[model samples]
Target chain A: MLNISNIVLEIFNILMKRIVLMGVIILMVVATVYLWLSNSGFSEGEGPYLGIIALILVFAVFLLIRRIKSWKVGEPQEDELSKKVMVRTAALSYYVSLYLWVFLLYMQDRVTFDKDRLIGIGILGMAIIFALSWVFHHFRGVPND
Target chain B: MTNRIKEFRVKLGLTQEELAKKVNVRRETIVFLEKNKYNPSLRLAFDLAQILNVSVEDLFSFEDEK
Candidate 1:
């Protein structure tokens, strides 16, 4: 008998498993690509390829963090420690971005501020937030499962 | 603040996990409540009290200073 609740539960489990599996696959692929690019002797300023690579990495890390945040297994729905770590990291990033903006105001006295520079700073802020969140989460006694 | 969560949970023979499931929260949240490490929001306290068959006032008491 195909119970509707049972079928829904099974589908949910399968979807969760697939999401986790996909995260692992993406990490592996990113690692392989990074390694291959580093080994390929691609010189700098090759049509902004390095910039493209960094963008890809930033996106990949963002997805990975989202996956980790949503992950729940073996009795606890959300990890409190991980949540704390994320909050702390985000706070730090916010402070850093604020300081950077203040510094930019000071720089305005010496040079003109442009839209491109502002956009670059925004991207840098987000990248720092993503990277620091992962680093804090990884180091804070909670093993990445 | 003090609460009757532990007493009610015990009376019902429900582990923190079971009560948490009924309340839609993590077990640690229940532990935090029992230990008074965390205070529940008004909505959460109301939900918990409803599930435990008690009024919010019955579930939680304010500290005298507060």
Candidate 2:
């Protein structure tokens, strides 16, 4: 006979998976729309709609992520392996973002474009590095420290 | 760190979920421990050893394989 605890655990796992998937889908959609808006806004001259779209998207994505993260907070503390992964990934993300900022600045000497756009790209690159590192560590084995 | 978690678990006739409960960890953690894919903390090792009716040294080993 199945125990009540077993049934509850099963339900919990299914709910967790669904919630995680929903978070992933939200991240993907936010990333796509953010990229598209950035590309089109700069290419076609800035306007009120572009500013409004960017602001709304940023706020919505920020709120959604915060909600999802808060939902995940608390519970079993991190394992030794998980702690190592987080520290390593965060350090890696920092270094990669630093180099990306330098690279973008270096490119500005050869090409003519909006310094504003370059600044935005630099900031976006850092966020991408952090997100990618988190995703990588989630799916991959421990990073080489 | 290779371990005899699966062997001991089988001997006790406990499912992964059941063992996880006794040890207070997720079932995936137990699965990984059994497969030698992840190392357990000292506390977890002790908990598993006790639940499986063995010593920590007997549960896992660091010596070279034969």
Candidate 3:
């Protein structure tokens, strides 16, 4: 019962899925590198790693912007439930980040905080948000049976 | 909330996908709404009413007994 158009659609869907997965992998690798660079001590004239990390962060931001810009919003687009789930997931992630930041502040004895650590936490928060949103979107209405 | 979306959609000879397109939502959203498993936002409800040519009250209902 598979028509040519159906086959093509399926292939496109698979390709899109693969691209998303790859994007996630790249993001994770960049995040790991960033964390490692931030935590490890560096010698004089060895600041290029930070520059490389900044470039990777910029690339990640660009990809996210591109994805959002290409997202369709109007008629024949994703339905109300999907939109609701998306909004809810984002809100949840924001609250989670807020609570975690508060906890970190409470645990620290010093009034001042490390800028690099703060930035690292921010990146991790965003990663968690995206991962959770994607998971919720994928599994929202599926039956357990 | 309960609705007669499926009946209206059928009467108008519109498929779920067609209605979703008209309402500016995803097809699965239409499915969920029809099944009464999901509630929509006020804006979305208004949009759906406009597309269905019905009032929000006509499209949706609230029951205290439920």
Candidate 4:
């Protein structure tokens, strides 16, 4: 039986997922702006905490958004190719992020940036590396075994 | 492994987007399949074969790697 209502509902659900993702991104941007611009009574040494907090918040929100999207769709959105690409991206980013952390640790003593700032940079770098790895795998194709 | 997905799809007058829709996958997946770059799961292979009106063996072939 052709369920027209279900089809319409599925379309609406897909739109809702897009809206949720966009909302999360907008909120992340606004929160980042607020963290940087608002002069609370925090000391200069405490400023890095704001960036780290914003980064964590955004990451958590994105994960939550993915969960919500899959829940709404009644299945994981990732198909076979996407799942493979995701696995490759995760493996690549895991090694790269570890290298980034080690590099940051090595430079902490020599660099003027404090440990807190270095931590923030490490978190941001990890996220960027993961995103870039995904893009690369998605376009370049995960090599077949 | 290599697949005749593009050949069969073309013979059937179906575009990549149409085939992807029939198989419930993204167009990019069909593109990869045609290029023999990404390996599809058994379920996906069965679905694609069914949609193309061909047997699984007729759709995909294993190449000897020496």
Which candidate has the highest DockQ of all? 4
lDDT of 3 by residue, A74-109 (tens): 342244566566677677777777777777667555
Query: What TM-score describes the B chain of model 3?
Result: 0.89
Model 2 CAPRI rating: incorrect
What local lDDT does model 2 show for residue A18? 47
Report the lDDT tens digits of candidate 1 across residue range A15-114. Answer: 4774677678767867876786788766663436456546757666665665554445334334454465467677777777777777776877788767
Clashes of each: 0, 0, 3, 0
C-alpha root-mean-square deviation, each candidate: 8.2, 8.8, 10.7, 5.8
Q: Pick the winner on TM-score between candidates 2 and 4.
A: 4
Top TM-score: which candidate number?
Answer: 4
TM-score of chain A of 3: 0.41
Candidate 2 TM-score, C-alpha based: 0.57
Which scores higher on lDDT, 3 or 4? 4
Ranked candidates (lDDT, high to low) = 4, 2, 1, 3
Backbone clashes counted, model 2 = 0
Which candidate would rank higher by TM-score, 1 or 4? Answer: 4
Q: Which is the better candidate, 1 or 3, if ranked by TM-score?
A: 1
Worst 10 residues of 1 chain A by lDDT: A136-145
Q: Write the per-residue lDDT of candidate 2 for residues A11-39, one digit (tens) a residue.
A: 67864664576567667867876787677
Q: Give Cα distance to truth, residue A41, candidate 1, Å.
A: 7.6
Q: Which residue pairs come into collision in candidate 3?
A: A75-B24, A78-B26, A79-B26
Model 4 quality (TM-score): 0.75
Score residue A13 of candidate 1 by CA lDDT: 85
Which portions of model 1 miss their true places by more than 4 Å? A1-33, A36-93, A100-145, B64-66
Q: Could you tell which candidate, 2 or 4, scores higher by DockQ? A: 4
Say which docking band candidate 1 falls in.
Answer: incorrect
lDDT of 2 at B61: 83
